[model samples]
Target: MTFKGVHRLLLLVFMGLALAGCQTEDTPAKPQFVSTTSDSRNSNYFIEFRSRYALSYGHTYVVFGRTDGSGQMINPEVAGLHPKSTSAVPYVIGHFVPVPAETGWSDGDLEEPYRSASWRVMLSQAEYNKVVRKIRDLQANSKFWQAALYNCNAFTGDVARSMGYSVPPIQLRPQEFVTKLREMNEGRRSVSPSRVLTAS
Candidate 1:
């Protein structure tokens, strides 16, 4: 053919490719907020954070479900420790509470003197495992818990990072840390605001 005939053929092909691209763009991607299950359907885990008022500086902790959806709470064990326990050679430990579902306390009823908020994590099963293992391993190490330094807030932050989540690096009080986490998770498919059960 001639030059004009060649030009017309090229234009038609370009228009066809553009239309195909537009069609592909019209299709929506699947939502990532839903929980991912393993081959045996064993992923009933949910990562959660709990924040409550404290006389000193407020408190924050991480909660998660067992493979069966049972609740477990982990926090630095410093409240009842004797002053001598944190003396010259300060020592701190962790408290792991595996709550029974039958108890109404699972919702975090702190009564008067305290208020709380929670957030549920929406991530894949594999990611959930990473988060859980991180917390559990830390819980097992008595050296990892420090009443002043590697406190519960730090613990939560570590777990969040292990799960591929991010929070501000600034030094934050417990409640502030919890608030920051919620803010960071806003609109993210990997996390969601959870029910807040307040007693006072």
Candidate 2:
């Protein structure tokens, strides 16, 4: 095959890999710690999108932090969206329309065995701050969650877009969402934020 043929074939491969995993979207235990803030070095800011198995479909979330000199993530913060109450009422209603949502760490966020996929990226201080700001805004203003609309994948996509990362379609499972994100941005090692963040 020619070079052009190879390129096109690779693109098709990735597209199929992503679409093949699509089907749906979990809940995890209460988190003991939150926020990527501590006596950590901000010289290197990083954000990681992760997925974990929960119930039938899995869950997606972001864990961001600074690394120590040894490159260990410190004070990792977790954020995501899910129904506010653990009861089946809100979650079931969320499938048809928006319902009360909670934007923070859920169960299995810190568990390795539960994680099915992860995509981590290093960001400039500017990009990191911008992403964090957007995360906060979404967390504060995102009062609803719906399986077909404002679910966990939607939440992570917002954060990714803030960092100028092209977001994949949202109607996918958590692991697929993260995988597609990494596949789509395989060339973007260091990217600028969508726009300069202004204080709000």
Of the candidates shown, which would achieve the greatest TM-score relative to the real structure? Answer: 2
Candidate 2 at 90: error in angstroms?
Answer: 1.6
lDDT of 2 at 23: 44
Model 1 TM-score, all chains together: 0.48
Task: Give all TM-scores, in the order shown.
Answer: 0.48, 0.73
Per-residue lDDT tens digits for candidate 1, residues 1-200, read: 99999988766664443233123111121121223322213445565565555434445666555433442333312111111232324321222111111101212323323545556553456666666666667555424434433455666676666655577542355555666676675444242223221111
Off by over 4 Å in 2: 1-42, 193-200
Candidate 2, 1-200: lDDT as tens digits: 99999988866665554344354443342222212222213456878888888774778899987867775788999999989986888876666557888999887787887978876665567667877888899999989887765788989999887766788888777877787777676454234532232111
Scored by lDDT, model 2 comes in at 0.71
Alpha-carbon deviation at 200 in model 1, angstroms: 26
